[model samples]
Each structure stands twice: as structure tokens, then as C-alpha cells.
Target: PRGLMSLKSFRDCAGEGMKAMMPANTILVLAWTISGVCRDLLQTPLFVKTMVADGGISGGLLPAIIFVVAGFLSFSTGTAWGTFGILIPIVVPVAQAVDPNLVLVCLSATLAGSVFGDHCSPISDTTILSSAGAGCAHLEHVSTQMLYACVVAASSTVGYVVSGLTHGSLLPGFASGLIFMVVTMLVLRQRNKQKDAAQA
Candidate 1:
């Protein structure tokens, strides 16, 4: 009979929402802080040693390596922004030391990797919110998107590798990455068709 709730009910709902959100916010902050601190501590010394030893990492492979590391950090933290904060400092200085021209390429790879990892991570807020907004199950969305994300990640890894080798010349790398993605998609589509036919 009481279709509309009272103002007190609305206020109670709002209060509960705030209470639920507060802890989540706190945990995100803690996650960001810890990730940043640990990366800073390790990277500072690691970069120093890297610079002193063999003039740092090779430009051809460093971006790919940075991408992998950034991706891992983002995946584990479930926060791309936190991964960026943790990786930028290390990536920039190390990239500069390795090859000043490759800094942009390395930074781009780091950003791409962070985003890719966030999209793939089950715990990432963006992934959760996307599934919730789409009115679908979170695991279903994650499982469906994971394949596409991994394919893109593979293409990006190759692109970064080529860019690093080419002294930050991205055109060839971009073209190659695009070709790789297209070919991979076609192969996957064919495989899916075969699988469906077999099932039928």
C-alpha cells in the first residue's frame, strides 16, 4: 500500500550508501600509496645500477619490458592510475638514460599497458562498473573481453618492441601492429566458425 517511501527512508538509504563507499575509497587510497612507495624504493636503486651497468637497458626492448611491468602492476593493484603513478618516474628516467628519443615511446607503452591490464583485471573498478552498467554478470563480461584485451596487448607489445628498435619511429610499428591484430582476428574468427560447425 505504501508505494512511496518517506523522507526518512531516503535519508537512511543515502547514509547506508555513504557508509558502504567510505571503506572502498579508503582501500583504493591505500592501494595507490603502497604501490607508489614500493615502486619508488625499488626503481630508484634499480635505475642507478642499470645506468652504471652497461649504460642501461637496450632501447629496442626496454619499452616492451616496461609495458610488461606496468601491466603487471596495474593488474595486481586493480588500478591503472596507481600503476601510472608508480611507473612513470621509473620509466621516464630509465628511458632517458637508455635513449632520450625513446622516452615518448616508452611512456606510451606504459600507459597502454596500464589501460590494457585494467581492462583485463577482474578486480578493476572500471571492469566492474562497466559490467554493472551493462546489466550483465561481471565474470561474463570479464571472460568475454579478456580474449580481445589479450590480443590487443599482444599487438601493443610488438608495437613497442618495434618502436624501441626503430628509435621511436612508430609508423612502421603501428602498421605492423595493425596487421598483426587483423590477422589474429581473422584467425580467431575462423577458429570460432570451425568450433561452431563441429558442435552443430
Candidate 2:
């Protein structure tokens, strides 16, 4: 009797797996290279001095700024890990310089923003893998997920601002963000229902 698992079947399976992983591998390499360069630049004294001297980046808005910057970087690179590697070292010191009490808040903002961007980015490995796993169009998956990601990001931005203003208190900031997210989601659902009714 023939073996249940043929050599030809194994070869085909391996080939398909490698093909599915190629995009993620390529993105990882590119993201790591870019992060290395950014890490070097960010560590320079000139860059640190300039950043610390920037008066606008201080006070109760610093966490919001950091969150936005982290989000944009991760979204453009499509790699949350790379974003974290690039931003954490730089942002942590800067936050400490600006306000010692805000170190944890800024760190949390960076993490949250990077996650939000990775979730929404079309080229992110997680996004790509999710679409492939679901057997759906990649762009369709990104488009569908973008709305929800944006809603959460908006809420998080508000939370960051509140946290910064309140000197890093978690409770009030979290409560405000949760309220905003619930209200926004409800509004979106109501609008969708109205549109569906009108179409029907």
C-alpha cells in the first residue's frame, strides 16, 4: 500500500507555506533596517537636544503628540514591533525630560498607538495573515477594520490628552475614553441602521 503522506504532497505544502510567508518576511526585513537607522539618529545628542528644546512638545499635550507620532510611524511602516523598537528608547527619555510623572503614560500611549496603527495598516503582517486566513480580499479586510480602528484611536487620543492633563492619572482618562468610544459606536450603529432602512 502507498504511504498516506506522499513526498509530492509534502513538497507542495511546503511551497505554499513559503509563498504565503514571503510578504511578511520581506516587510520584517525592511522594517528592521529602517528602525536601525532611526534608532541611530534618535540617539544622537543633537537630535535629543533639539527635541528637548522644542517647547511645543512639552506640558499637557506631550502624550497626545507622542501617540500621534507613534501611530503615524507604525502605520507607514506597517510594523508595530519596529515602531516600538524605534520609539520607546527615544520617547522614554524625552518624556522623562519633559515630566517625570508622565513616563508610564507616554509609554502606554506609544504602545496603544502602535497597536492601533498595525491593526489598521493594510500591509501589516497581522492584517495580511488575517485576510489570508479568512480567505477574503486583503484590501477588503483592511477597509472593514479601518473604521473600527479609527474609532478606538480617536478615543485613545482623548484618553492620552486627559492623562497628560491630569498628571498621569489612569482612572479619569480611562473613563473618558470608554465613554467616548461607547457613544461613538452607538452613533455609528444608529447611522448604519438608518441607511439600511432607507435602502430597504
Candidate 3:
């Protein structure tokens, strides 16, 4: 019986695998470095004190702000994991200092925003791979998905605002978001129907 794989074959396969993973590995390393630096900065008493003193990012606004920032960063970078690594460390300490009760809500917002960005970002690896796997044009896939992603994102932003304002109450935030999403979708569908009728 031939060996499971010849030595040369195995080496070539391993090399290819490493080459494929290089970009992801580089992003992970960079994200980790940024997180570490953020953690160190947060540890400084002066930094923490200053952040707490900054009245601009009050508890009522922190979740919405974090969500937007995390979403923007993840969209630009095209990697949710990197966004998580970069934002979580910074957001955690800041949230705790600003409002301990908001820590969990802020964390959830960060994760949700990162995922939302990754879902809609054209450059995201998952988005690219999904299009490739479906044998569709990448831009077409991005464009089609963007509309729904934007709707969800809008509703989520509202939910975050409500949750933050309510001091982390989950029900009101969730219900408001769900209702907003449903109404938005119904309106879009009706408008599309009217436009189609007019065209026909």
C-alpha cells in the first residue's frame, strides 16, 4: 500500500494551507496587539478617571455609541473577530467605569454590531466566500444583502438606544426593535408593489 501521502505532497499541501491562512493570521495578531495596548491604557488610573469624567458618553448613550463605532470599525476592517478583539477590551473597562450596570448591554451591542458589519461588508471574508460558494457576482451579492442588513441595523440601533436609556431592560428594547423592523419591511414591500404596478 502506498503511504497515506508522500512526504513531498504533504509538505506542498501544508504550504498551501499556510499561505491561505496568512491574511487571517495577520489580522488576528494585529487585533490582539491593539487589544493589549488598550487594556494597558485602561489600567492607568488617570485614563480611567478621565473617561469616567467625560460626561459626553453617558450611560444612556454608551450602547448606541459603541454599536455604531464597532459596526463602522468592523465594516472597514472586514473582520468581526478583529473588531471584537479590538473593541471588547476598551469597551469593557470604559463601560464599567461609566456605568457598571451597562457592561453587559454594551458588550452585547459590540458583538451585534460587529456581526452586522461583517454580514454586510463586501470585503468580509465570509461575505466573499459566500458569494463564491453560491457562484454569484460578489458585488451583486453585496448589493442585494445590503438593503436587508441596513434595515436590521437601523432597528438594532433603536433597540440599543432604548436599552441604554432604560438601564439595560431587555424587553422594551427587543419589542421596539421587532416592531420597527416589521413596519419597515411592510412599508418597503408595499412601495415595491406599487412601483411594479406602475411600471407594468
Candidate 4:
């Protein structure tokens, strides 16, 4: 019935400040935050532990490896969101007690790892939907998506390292590093485009 913000002038509320910065996608961030809240609220600890079995918690590399295995299976199950629902509650509190300072770092690792698992799995719903939607064979979707997810996951690990060093702040920290990732992706895209153009 009503159009959403024909003018969308935020300067009326916060001077020219909001209009000058982050105007195009603040709503997207807000929507994501709301979704995160819903996910958190519905998260159940017992269910999480049920999904995460006891093993590597007893020793060194084992715990980390266990997380990796869990990440892979949960995601391959075609439900990263569900996998996260089953892991974060179990991971977060223990991670926080281990070191309050590294909370975000640990969370990012867990979340991103799960996404890595789910996105490339042949049976994953998104993977299936993507192939079906694009009119491509399912294996092609899985194959191509795997390459990008691996690269991004590698970048994300480096991002977590930088964010941890700087206390995960936006100013001269996480935000600045994001610019590097964006630039890297853009340059890669341009290179591919040029190669395609030359071949054409």
C-alpha cells in the first residue's frame, strides 16, 4: 500500500552524517541482526551438545580437529543454520570462559566453518536450490561453490587473526581489513573478466 521511503533522507534525523555514511545497507545489517537474535533465542544447549559429541575436548589438536569434523558433517547435512544452532551455544560459553577477549574470534571460526561445510555439500539445500534455480547440473554448483568458499574461509581466518589483534573494533581494525578483502575480490574479478574478454 505504501512505498518504502521515497526520498529516504536520514539527514533530517542525523544531519548529513547518516546520509554520508552507510546509507545504502544499514537496513540489511539491521535485518541480519534481527535474524541473529531470533536464532539465538531459539537455540537450545542440550540440543547443541547432542549435535556435538564428546571426544577432542580431552586433548590438544583433537579438539580443534573435532570441531572441523563437526563443522563438515553438520554443514554437509544441508543445514548450516541448524548446524550453528547446534554448535554456538555449546561453543560460545566454553570459548568465553577460555578467554573473554577471543569470544568474537572463536564465534567467527565456528560460524564460518559451518558455512564452509554447508555451501559446498552436494546434498545441501542451498546447493541444490542454486543448481536448480540456475538450470545447471548439481555437481557443477557444488564444484564451483567449493572454490569460492575455501578462499573466503582462508580470508576469514586471516580476518579473525587481525580482528583479534585489534580487539575486533571497526576503527582501524576489522573494518579496515574488510577493505583489503573487498579490494582483493574486486581485483580477482577484474582479472577474470579481462581473461574472458580476451578469449571472447
Candidate 5:
């Protein structure tokens, strides 16, 4: 009986397939969890107040700022849902106070930013699962995806700005942002081609 079963067969039967996958990645998993907790702890009320302060930050800029801030928070925490839970309540009231009209745009920006950051963060569960599912190194997956994430984020930032300026009308902002993203990608592709040619 023992001779008939190979190590691979035993591993498949005893849940070793799942258990073996975790030992090497335990440190990384713990580190990510700790960092997320620390980030949440440090999200202070003063920071929220400063971000929404009306003197220097105009209504037109509010959405863009919220996007940037939410992105940073989500990236640090590696959790888009957590970022949304923390930010939406604060964003809504502050945006309403600043300009009741800008509230919807600001909320939209916040949600988009959270997703953008979580998509890119190495510590995010989706990112981890994606790398694992692809059977690639986690860091390799993160590095490869970072460029695209940054490009999308920049486009979203521009879109949020336009939406805020237009009093929450997203169509024009969305169109312009799409155009900007396409043009930027084309330019980058051309540059990469030139570099490859030079190398050759």
C-alpha cells in the first residue's frame, strides 16, 4: 500500500497542497496585515480636517484631492473596502460643507481611488491571489502591474478634476480622461519601441 502511494499522492490527500503553499509566504502575509492595522490606526481626525479645509483647497480641486488621499490610504492599508469605510463618511460631510454640489463627484472619486490603490498594492488580497493563481512571484506580479495602475490613476485624477469643476457632470470628464489615457499609452508604446530598436 505504501509503495503504491507516492509523496505527491499523499500531499494531495492530506491538505498539504494548501498547507504547503503557505509556509514560505507566512512572513509576508503577517507583515501586510500588521501594516494595514498600523495605517488604520494612524488615520487621524486632524488629517481629515486639513484635507477638507476650505481656505486653500477650492471646490474644483476637492474631488482630485479626495482621490489622491483615498488612493494613498488604500495603498497603505492594502484594503479598498477599509478605505471606503473610513473615507466615505468623512468625504461626504466635508464635501457637502464645501459645496453641496460637489458631494457626488467627491464620493465617486474616493471610490475610484480606493479601487485603484487596492488593485496596485502588493499587499492587497486580490493582488496576492492574482499572483498566486498565475503561479508567479508576488513581487514580480506587483512590479509588472504598477505601470498600468499609475497610468489609470493619473487619468482618473484628471477626470475627477473635470467633474468637480463641472459640478458633478462626469460625461465630459470621462471622455477627456479616456482620450488622455489612450494618447499617453500610445506615446509610451512608441518610446518603448524606440528603446528596443536602439538596444537591437
Candidate 6:
């Protein structure tokens, strides 16, 4: 299937092909879905209130909080897809009605934030899934993935300000940023290797 590959394994040159040199290096993921209702039941009510807060004070800023809370929930639950599903639709309509112009940016910010949290989170399902599939440790996957995603996310935030509307574009806004990021990472890696070789 040629599923996901790890940046650490790529940079470290752990093995020449799909097979990992160290079999125990990988994490194993559980494929069956967790019950979403059970998850909601377990989440902190105080935190939920904060995300879906109403009125003048906490009201308008709720989207920002939704992003943050969803992040924590996703991280712990290990499934960003599930967490985001719960929050996005709830936040969208409200944000749109409040300020049409700011809605896109706000929404991107929220999505970006959710991704940011999930990428770094030890328990995030993507982290676990990637690690399990890549034959890498969960932490290894999280650390490397976090750096890669953060670079693109920061860049995407800028792009959001410039081109984040129905006034424009398509998907893999995720993938495009990832390409520039890989190039930048490679350049940085080459520089470090050179420095290390010279010092050696």
C-alpha cells in the first residue's frame, strides 16, 4: 500500500526500503472506532462551556476556544478527525453570522490550531496511526510530524489571510505547503550534515 512514511526514518535512513531494520520500532494502532457519544460523555463540561460559550464576553471568542478545546480533546482521544467533526459545524454558522469577512480566517485559524495540537499530541490517532504504519515509535512520529506540520501551518496562516475564501482555491492547501516545507527541511538537513562532516 505504501502508506505513510516517517520523516525521522527518511532523514535517518533507517532502512533502504519498506521494511524497517528494527521491528519493535513501530507502534500498533487499534482500527476499530471509539464511541463518540462516550467521548462526549467523558469530556469536561467546564471546557465544553468555554468552547461553546455565549454572549458578549466569552461569546464572540468561542471559536478561538473551540479550536483549543477541540485540540485537547483530540490529543487525548487520539482522533482529530472525530474531534474536529464534533466542533466545526457547531462553530461555523455562528461565526459566519457574526462576521462574514472574518469567518474564513477564524475558521482556518481553528482548523490550523486543531492540526497543530494533533500533530504534536502523543495520543493523537494520526500520530499513533502514522507511527504504527511507519514502523516508528509514536513519540518519534509525533516529534517529526509536529515540526513538518507546524512549518506548513504557519505558512498556511499567512495564506489564509491572502487567499482563504470561496473567492478562491482548492484543497491540498495542506499538500502544497508541505512541498515547500520538505524542500526547506532538506536544505536545513544538508546544511547540518555539512557542518557535522566538517567538524568530524
Best by lDDT: 3
Q: Candidate 2, residues 27-86: lDDT per residue as tens digits?
A: 667666665676575454246536656745555787888899889988998988878877
- The sequence of per-residue lDDT tens digits that candidate 1 reaches over residues 92-129 is 77777768888899899889989988889999988999
> Model 6 — TM-score against the truth?
0.46
Report lDDT (Cα) of residue 27, candidate 2. 64
- Give the root-mean-square deviation of each candidate in angstroms: 4.6, 4.1, 2.6, 12.2, 6.8, 12.2
Model 2 ranges with Cα > 4 A deviation: 1-54
Between candidates 1 and 4, the TM-score winner: 1
**lDDT tens readout by residue for model 6, 1-200:** 26476787675665555365232223221211223332345443334444444433434444345455665665665555555555555445655554455456556655766677767788765577778999987777777777766666555544443333322233434455456667777888999999999999
Off by over 4 Å in 6: 1-73, 161-194, 197-200
Superposition TM-score, candidate 4 onto the true structure: 0.52
Instruction: Give the alpha-carbon lDDT of every model.
Output: 0.82, 0.83, 0.88, 0.59, 0.81, 0.55
Query: Candidate 1 regions off by >4 Å?
Result: 1-57
| The 10-residue segment with the lowest total lDDT in model 6 | 24-33
Candidate 6: pairs in clash: 78-125
lDDT of 4: 0.59
Query: Tens digit of lDDT per residue, candidate 4, span 11-45?
Result: 36565766655632453454445446644674533
Model 3 stretches astray by more than 4 angstroms? 1-4, 41-53
Pairs that collide in candidate 1 are none
TM-score comparison, 3 vs 6, better candidate: 3
Over 100-161, each residue of candidate 3 has an lDDT whose tens digit, in order, gives 87899999999999998999899999999999999999999999999889999999999999
The full ranking of all candidates by lDDT, starting with the best, is 3, 2, 1, 5, 4, 6
Please give each candidate's TM-score: 0.79, 0.78, 0.88, 0.52, 0.74, 0.46
